[model samples]
Target chain A: MHDTTDQHLFERVLQDNDQLADENRHHFDDMGAYVVNFMSAPGAGKTTLILELAKRLKDKLSVSVIEGDMVGDLDAERLRTAGVSAFQISTGRSCHLDAAMIARLLHATPHPEGQMIIIENVGNLVCPAEFPLGEHLRIVLLSVTEGDDKPIKYPVIFHNCDAVVLTKTDLIDHVDFNFETVEKTVKALNPKVELFKVSTKNGDGLDEFLAWLEARHSITLTASAV
Target chain B: MHEAAVALAILKRAVAAAEASAQKEEKAYAETAENTAPIFDVVKIVVQVGEFRNIDAESLEFTFSALRKEFPRTQNTELELINIKAIALCSLQNHQFHPEPANYFSCTICGGGIQNLISGKELDIVNIEIEQCLTETAA
Candidate 1:
């Protein structure tokens, strides 16, 4: 029996301290809060959706946002104007926002009472999906302009996401985006994932989306009450 | 994309281990001239990486090369990446582990569902096979 040294090496590697982000996740859980990690490709309307969700839910629920980008605080600035507490996390040259980054952002922006924090991860489908920010929900947004085959091309992101929010439905008529194909593919990848088709411009289907969110919040509250 | 960060973490750990091993060997060599041998020779480092980990092997290789240049002792070490296939273990029913590579794995018992990241999510230094250098006196 060639005592395979590989297994010993693997165990040693696993023992390495690679979880600097786990602490932040513990803090988030302690707050009895829900964090939504929003991911998508560049210009997929993540910021716009955050703005809309903030405005609609701010009065009803305590809402804050941790906006991530390669540089600049533009998204955080925009979120601030929308009347939601916003904190910007510029990744410098990093492509994705990891749990460590979110943990730092949390220190900069303390958890607010009765509010759920939304982490708008840097717009990249691949890298963002790899790191978990201890979010209760992972929402991957796809706009009509990005095409329908996106789910197929990036199945990992779709598969890991708790829900898929299809943005820019207002331009569905302008583009040849097929809802059927997108829905079918997403379902095939993840049957239990909640799907929402929304148009921020026209406010179409937003109410239903909000209702779904309210139900989720209510469930959280009930669980916490016990 | 984020492989650089992962690579950095792995490199730091490897360096620490190498340094510790090297120091122990150096102490033993000082005690006896016959025990004097080059701590280890350059060979290969095998690492198991999970598919879901999203580690770019090429990028990691590049980063390692650059980092190794800074640490003269670790130069010329080859990084052999082994991708581990992920198996989804559903938290729903009795924490059952599923070996199937599917889009998602659900637990039938608790309904607690999570993407089973089975194998590919690894960043480890599997083994370093170093050639034991013979002392000048022995030769």
Candidate 2:
């Protein structure tokens, strides 16, 4: 008799990844470090934003960066040049970096005192939104050149991100970037999201953006102290 | 575009999981006389995604179909998509509602529609159908 028994695995496929992500979160928690997952589209200024954040928060806190990319450590090298401890995870075939990759990366590196994990996820708003990667906070970048309708079209990233940074604002007037429409659209997607309009080129609005990190770092530090 | 990334993940995980299953089955059948390890044929894959997940199931399928050719384990596999609509709960009013995604919706009872997102964030592989190699010997 021919037999046919189909396997029913109601298992959540992303569950394994999420479990690994939770483990990563636990590692950071024990270290009293806050993990920030930075996500965005290509050329949206995420690397530049991260570099700026590193420079501003240099003396105040020790920052460790984990860079995820299709194949290149250019961003990691840039961060290293700036005196930041940067690690790169190259995903040859994978488009996005999963929690297991992070687990392996951190295992090979030593944990420094009072260090924060700044993870620059593979630059794609869609896939990165699904993987948590054990981040305490999620920041998505939006460059002025990219259309204002991105928030509505790619609502998942906007909705899930803890904050939105409108990058390259200095070039706002040069491009057809409508500031009001994007802000309204972002708020429509995530009502309570904290938004910052910044430009790393001319150094406009960097202080406020850096202050936001300062506030978050202090809050985490306070909680860990208690 | 995002589907390209997702499709790669789906095929990779499916292969990885099937390999583990094959190993386990081989070890369990070691005591039997016909101790041939099962070679799996992945016939179908079911992916469950939320409306708010911002993934196009059609696009994912296209991408998966294109990329499946590279994987020997899943070249002829079929894809099934389960779409989940986004839902919100008005805990203050004890009411739940399904709001249109990307819209600023308020709870009907409390006037605060964006109270909380209860569902529609799921992006998971819910099921996989693999035909196991079970050649029965004559008893």
Candidate 3:
């Protein structure tokens, strides 16, 4: 091996990732499905919110979930129990799932026919935000337990997201979460991002969230039909 | 941190360039002894680290130093980091926004508040400077 030829190695690394990104986009388009990459910190209620959404929209919309975690198939199991088709992706030592990983996972699992696919990214407010998985929309979750300053602290995730979900809203009374402050911070990061405040246990504001999903699905269907 | 990864990438590039320059100089030195001259004294690598990228300058420097040690050709080279500030443009407010000091604003038109993060979130190697040795003129 030539010692000075190491420069080509750098180009190869970047090129490999770029190719993976392209393949992911192609798969997403070929399936004629809209993918939503769900990102948030730990205990942000991503799984619970997804289960709730699946329960509500499963009959009307074909829903599938791709659960990502360092280990354990608990999230996929939870979705299956909720009557939603699910696949688990255990990343092992990886902090964030890249497009290459997702592309391989999609190949292993059967694609949902003309359905909406949700990828629950590893519970990270940072690294996952930097890598794009060819998802149509990026949704970020912030629970009441996390504090109102989360949007300000993890601004990159908030800024890149198409929508922000305030989960575990039922605990607002128990926790010191200031809705006004959180809203102010979120709006400051993304002026046009759709905001949804939801509670899976109490069934509060869930209808609005479901309506938003249906509206987005309808738009995608219409656009694809044309 | 991701910046450490980025710095490693930069260091590899710099070392590669230095090796190439050294090779060219060696070739010239063999062909004409009179033209034997130093290719460059030092190489300056300018990188822009942005706040949005969440890269720690100190961590990047440390990582770069460690990686540079592996490249003997770039042992004497210097790594220069130039941070590029980040700015956010709020569609609601129709204004250029900055985040230093961390200020948030509310839009008057739609009553929607906006936060304009102005600094941090940049990761790039903007340019590099190389020093060339001068040749002596014969009288």
Candidate 4:
């Protein structure tokens, strides 16, 4: 053991994650599937929103979900029951689902090609933003009950997301949630991020959200056609 | 929560790179790289911690300290984290400032709307201090 003190610029920590994410992207591109990674804090109603989306787009496009949780296939089962092909990825103790996990799941479960893969990331705000699951869209759900300052408090997730969905709007009037503040904060954080407010319970604001999704899904359809 | 996995990733990546370097050395110089590689002991790891990343340095350090022993080379490695302050830049005012007490960030200077992020999301190893075995070569 020759001991010499030498400081070497060895690695940037997330480079391996980036490589795997790239591989996931290449796989999606090859399969002609547009992947969307959905993230939110626990109880922010990500699953509810997903269920609503599946209900709306069931016939418009081929859709599937990769449910990521620390444990249980409850979400996957729910999605399957809701009439969408769903795959479960139990991350065990891992907080966030990495690209390698997605790649492995894709290889293992043969979902219909050209179907959109909506990855419902583990219910955490912080870690999921750091990981890119090779998704074309990164959608972050911020429920009204979680407070409006979430965009500022949890800035990275809000800033990094391609789209922001304000879920559980049915509780807006019942709670002290200031929609104005959330909107202002979101705009302040990321001007480019598309904002959609929806109540999965009432099906309110589902049209606009579904339209946005259909537009994105159409990109895959066009690409596949080409 | 993610810190443990992150610590593990750091060790895994460092060890993998060291091994790859050793192999390349063995192949290239026939024996020089291998001879100079010593034992692939990682002495210190410097990770740039960004405020926006939401990873607590204390938590990461604790995790790294606890998990380093699991790996071959990182048993005694010191994990050094450089805290990169999260900067909030107001696009309207064309200004950037550290969001002090930084939660619920707004432009500290001007009350601008767009808080454009300049930096502080880094998740990379800035540098690594390792034990390198040096030897005299045919000059």
Candidate 5:
């Protein structure tokens, strides 16, 4: 006999990934670490900003980094040379770091020492936005050299992130970047998001950003304790 | 491409769904000694892809076609993807309008910012169809 049956799933494809992410959250909570997931286009100054942030946070709090890259560990190497705790995950073909990748690393190795953990996701504006890495905060960096219209052109990334950092302010004069447009557009997309303008070359605006991070870190730690 | 990964995910889920149905059919037809175990064949799969997901249909289909061969259950399956439009509700006037991909921050009707997204961030499997066949041997 020939018979057909139709089943309705109506299931979200990312549900598995999201469940894994929640498990990662439990691991982070047990370790009492505040996690941050950073995303940006390639060469958007993510490495430089992370390097500087790690250096500053190291003095008062223990900080470690998990860098995700498609190739070499150049960025992770730089962080280690500066005496920061860093581990690298090389994603051979994947453009984004899913929660499963983090689970593999966290389970295989001992917890990296730190009250704060930073995950520098593989550089891509589109795909990275789809994956969540169990971070307390999500930041998307946009360099002035990449133009101010990026917030509007890639609205989904800006909309989903917790914050947006305007990087490479030192090169703003050389490029045709508009700060007002970027701020306005990002605000329209995510009104509650924190905005920061930073220049790793000059160390400008790093203090304010760091202060905000510290405050959030303390709040996260306090919340986890109870 | 990320589409390749997505295609694999879709195929994996579809295969599992078919296997589940086949198990039930096998149990129900067990009473007939002459009836052979049921064979399950996936016929069609419907997926809804949101505009915000930024997935290219051509690339997804190409990868799915190549991967379906690897899964015996889905070798005969056909994939149908429906594009979900990007929609936003205006904060000021409560108007709902389809926003352009480049400029989704603002509502076209009221010229006000979006309050919240009403729809279009969905990457979901709507349904799947399977054909089950039973062979009766001579008593």
Candidate 6:
């Protein structure tokens, strides 16, 4: 018997996942769909926000959703009931939705007729940040009821996301949440992260959020056309 | 837990690497000696886990230990995890500081935001130690 310690270096353990995500990006580009991966803690109102956005964008552009949950099709059922096209992926034991899951869904349903495809990732801050599902943009929801220190607590998710939607703003007055703290911490983690104060119930900042999404979707459409 | 998934990936990579090294050694030995069976045993796998990754070392180790018994090559393998500290560069003061656990957004000195993270957030399989055994097979 001979013992040998081979000097090998694999830079990232998630290299295979990243490669699959890149392939998914190419696929999304071919379909001319602007993909957004939504991540947040549980009960962050991801479904409600998507439904609101879909209702507003229905006349202008088509919107589709891919809902991911640990077990059940509850969110997908809600979206479908609201007259939006939604697909459900039950992850079973997985905390986060990996690129392979998305690839499998896409393979089964080759094309979705939405100019925008929003993937509502399994609700978790830490694990979801580690996996990228070929998304052109990543949005994280932080409700006012969840405390302002969440950005500090889960810095990676906030740092990696393209936008931070401060949800449940209508209840901001009732809660002890401080907006400035979240803004400062989120900016500290991500300098260029777009911050939005949104309340799906009151529709306070929904237009601004919709505008931002539409602008990005238009850019994706233009880029795909070229 | 996500650590379970990560542990599985680590084990798969380690076993694959051990088998690859064994195959190469077997090919080289076949030229010199015929009718010999080569067995590869994974001894140790070194993984680097960054502080920012939110991975629990004990959980990862436990999951890896539980799963390694499934693979004969890795049945007796030892998993070594090296923790890498997170260091971020403050944009305002240009200073580097260890971003405390769960408070990685702000700088320690200036309390300003970080321009970019200098280190941490690393998850990699650095190296593996393999033991190769050769025994003559009955022809």
- How far off is residue B75 in model 2, in Å? 6.6
Candidate 2's docking class is acceptable
TM-score of chain B of 6: 0.89
For model 1, how does the per-residue alpha-carbon lDDT over B68-109 read when each residue is reduced to its tens digit?
656544577667788777555553443644332233234445
Cα lDDT for residue A105, candidate 4: 83
- Output per-candidate TM-scores for chain A, rounded to 2 decimals: 0.90, 0.93, 0.89, 0.92, 0.97, 0.97
lDDT of prediction 4: 0.79
The residue-by-residue lDDT of candidate 2 on B1-139, one tens digit each, is 5578678878887787667666776766667777655666677888888887768878888899999898866878888898888787753574677655334344545544344677887777778777664543323
**Of the candidates shown, which would achieve the greatest DockQ relative to the real structure?**
6
What do the candidate models score in CA lDDT, each in turn?
A: 0.71, 0.79, 0.72, 0.79, 0.85, 0.87
DockQ, all models: 0.25, 0.35, 0.14, 0.49, 0.62, 0.64
lDDT tens digits, residues A60-169, model 2?
Answer: 88888889999989999999998888888998876677888888876774633346779999988788887788888899999989988787677778878789999999
Task: Report the number of the highest-lDDT candidate.
Answer: 6
Per residue, candidate 3 scores C-alpha lDDT tens digits across A141-179 of: 999999988887787788788899999988888999888
For every model in order, what is the number of clashing pairs? 11, 3, 13, 3, 0, 0
Candidate 6: misplaced stretches above 4 Å? Answer: A223-226, B32-34, B101-104, B134-139
Per-residue CA lDDT of model 6 for A73-107, tens digit only, reads 99999999999999999999999999999999988
Give each model a TM-score. Answer: 0.79, 0.80, 0.76, 0.88, 0.94, 0.94
The candidate 2 chain A region of ten consecutive residues with least summed lDDT is A1-10
Question: DockQ of candidate 5?
Answer: 0.62
For model 3, the stretches where C-alpha displacement exceeds 4 angstroms are: A1-19, A109-114, B1-45, B63-79, B90-93, B105-121, B128-139
**Candidates ranked, most accurate by DockQ first:** 6, 5, 4, 2, 1, 3
Off by over 4 Å in 4: A1-3, A219-226, B20-37, B99-104, B113-116, B132-139
Q: Model 1 off-target regions past 4 Å?
A: A1-7, A11-18, A109-114, B23-43, B85-125, B128-139
Instruction: Answer with 2 or 3, whichever has the higher TM-score.
Output: 2
What's the TM for chain B in candidate 5?
Answer: 0.87
